[model samples]
Target: MPQHFLLSAEARNLSPIAIARMSEYEAVMTMKKLRWGEGKDVICPRCGKKHEAYYIKSRKQWQCKECNYRFSVTAGTLFAHHKLPLRDILFACSLYVNAAKGISALQIARDLNVQYKTAFVLLHKIKEALKVHKQRETMQLSGVVHMDATYVHSSQKPKNKKSERVDRRLKQHENPLKRAILVIRDSFAKQDDEQNTKQIGARNTIAFIAKSENSKVVNQLANKHITKGSTIHTDESPAYDNLIYFHDLKRVNHQKEYRSDAGVTNNLAESYFSRFKRMYYGQVHKMNNTYLYEYANEIAYREDTRRLSNGVIFNDVVSKCLTSLPSDDWRGYWQGNKKRVETLAA
Candidate 1:
């Protein structure tokens, strides 16, 4: 959990060249086997049975002994439905882990010699897989938890709806459908211990869209993601007033001082918000509200695992893809459904 552990994980996984050096068939076979179970035991994607299928070498698939069904290693998974070769998939994964900040779909297309559509879908699938991992493995923050909120405006814009009469203040949020972010971080926990059991802080993050920074919203978030008796730190926000009775509440007055007499500051949460805002405004350019949860989840995952090596991060993302269902398809991706991100914080 000490920062040194991230450096240690770097030298452990095989270099990208080594993984890329694998034959197309070999790489596919190896990763698929790893996804299903042991590298030797192939799972029947049709029936979800392990060690009960025979590898049909000629056709490169499995014959489930139980169901007598035919399937490929990628069958039933997002990779199962893709037309790209397994090697290309693995290489794309390598790119994913290497680009800690994030690699755009255009970059992936150029690197893999694939169409923009293919690259975009592949990356979105991985992000969605990350979302599934987040939802399934939601962590509760204990010791010294920090909570704060920020906003990311909707990308939608009005072409001619705006006129000179528009209030100057209203112009700032043209698409006033602002997306509120509620984030909580464990100030006392490390990402993981030497054993990699994820005890202290491997996955301790709470984030999701909120309606407003109101007392009801803060109170709900505190009760849900934060555990009882844990100390909560924040700025002098009226919304957090309700949390005082339930939690060991402490606050810092930003107007007068950054830190209080008790050494309380929501700096950790602010640091996370700053990084997220930069990534959102600078890198991603714009975010559609529909997939906001997945994007936020990616931020949490990246920040939480920032210390881990690219190889380890790549491996973890791919492992989660095995059980993850794909998100909205290509055509529907941009068509926003405007789902209320509240109550659905990953």
Candidate 2:
């Protein structure tokens, strides 16, 4: 049998040790290449000009000739005002891209030998960058789409005494922090010229967080993301029954079998949930409701890029960090500047 893709050497294009060995100058040059490409043009965030800015050798910043505004490589980007060295930031991205499920901030702290708070904020900044870049694309999934919902923070721990334990499955006993991650995945289709007649796997994915998996929220999200007339595959949940009015809906009853006789299945969405559960239960053991959407979207990104090599994923993530604007929620996070509201789908 052929070896798996990730187990092959081609998939191991990036090495964290190489990034760690990079000098400060090499790190800066690398960031410059990723940020501005081969060209020497450096746009001043202040003056908003694409003209080549004067390089300050001592400070390693650019002075825009247009308006005399000075800016560093990370200025105006998600890594703006960063306290860590550029090499360490690049190493962190390498580690992040290599983690298949997800990497915990605690683990990152131990590896980078930084404070837990710093590692936490650094990882969040990366996530926020990814979220922003994905939003900027304004992606809309088409073709064979799979939709499903999964719950987190819904189960309560049992008490030591059997008599003291409450029925957690009961609606009233359910944890109030319970939230659902609604996933919609677009499947990969075979090209017309290809001899393969089978369609397999999900190509792209989008996710949303809600208080619960209800029809109102489901309809609203599906209508917004899924194009009209696209076929949507989902489980036999009443919440998805309403999607039939907008698109061709196919349902497979999980209570009976994973796939129906007609070859209908929501496995694409299930595949996304499988990785999410690994990240949640195995890595990030405790997650608050406030940033649950970010976590979900991160998993979606991982799943969609599963076929790509670590080098490609690393470059894509680094490019996103460079292009994403400074985060409002996490800029002064350690200084008590934080988002007070939770993100929920309407």
Candidate 3:
């Protein structure tokens, strides 16, 4: 698809608010309805031939007449091979994406009334889905791209046995088990030609969970999505000092001045992190690195779709979940939804 057309199509479909209010079962059923026979014969997986298929809503499966093949709607998709009711999965995804910070597995289990392990596994699956979607897109964070980092605690830390050098090192940096999230924000130009300042436009976020605050990591991320010569804004963290090596880097020393000649700052990204920290600290409390990135993507995805109505968000997430690639598992589907959310915001 042409980039603009694909983007516009996604924009028309993107909505986060709607998804928040939906029950998991309803979302799954709705997705099943959209993917089922819409005046077209179901293609037989075994023969690759179009077959007459009838929907058995009770079982949520399709029975083919020509081949006598019966398959559940979730058979080939991520929803297949799961023992959890479709409703619980859908609800988990809804809760997962809607929260600004994140929902812990225990909380998810409580809300869905499932086991903690079930909730944990479900969250991991959805996160894996989000990761697949991230790999599919090419980001062009043109205009002003704000960059910054925030810390999130890991789920577990090794016990200290003795004069523990590693433990001491970790404590020196405000907890060694904490992971840093590097985020980038796109700043749009505001009206008023006289001010000539970049106004905040639609906001989107890309988060990386890293151990060390290093320029190499920042540049690696920049090279992936940002175009050459694009204006980049960041605080005077030594790690970001080398950004000029790649893009049009501009710096604001938070220790001194907060703005530069570009009249832009990393405040946008910082504001996002503040919201993230509140949720991470207040609601969920703790998360491991494995799940931290997923939660970050979920939060970012919701923020991108905050303006849309609840119904729109629900439909968009379902649609993106259906069409996303790599692994069609639950995690892949959510990741795909996140990618679509980011693209629409862009």
> Who wins the TM-score comparison?
2
- TM-score winner between candidates 1 and 2: 2
Per-model TM-score on C-alpha atoms = 0.83, 0.95, 0.72
- In candidate 2, what are the lDDT values of residues 106-151, reduced to their tens digit? 9999999999999999999888988887777777788999999989
**Clash pairs of candidate 2?**
none
- Considering every candidate listed, which one attains the maximal lDDT? 2
Task: Predict model 2's lDDT versus the native.
Answer: 0.90
Candidate 1, 104-171: lDDT as tens digits: 78888998898887797788788878876777865778888888888778444445655634443564
C-alpha RMSD values across all candidates: 4.3, 2.0, 8.5
TM-score of predicted model 3? Answer: 0.72
lDDT of each: 0.73, 0.90, 0.64
- 188-281: candidate 3 lDDT, tens digit per residue: 5666478775434545677777775678788788887677788888877888777797688888888777776657678878777777877777
Error at 241, model 2, angstroms? 1.0
State the lDDT at 38 in candidate 1.
60
In angstroms, give how far residue 174 of model 3 lies from its true place. Answer: 8.0
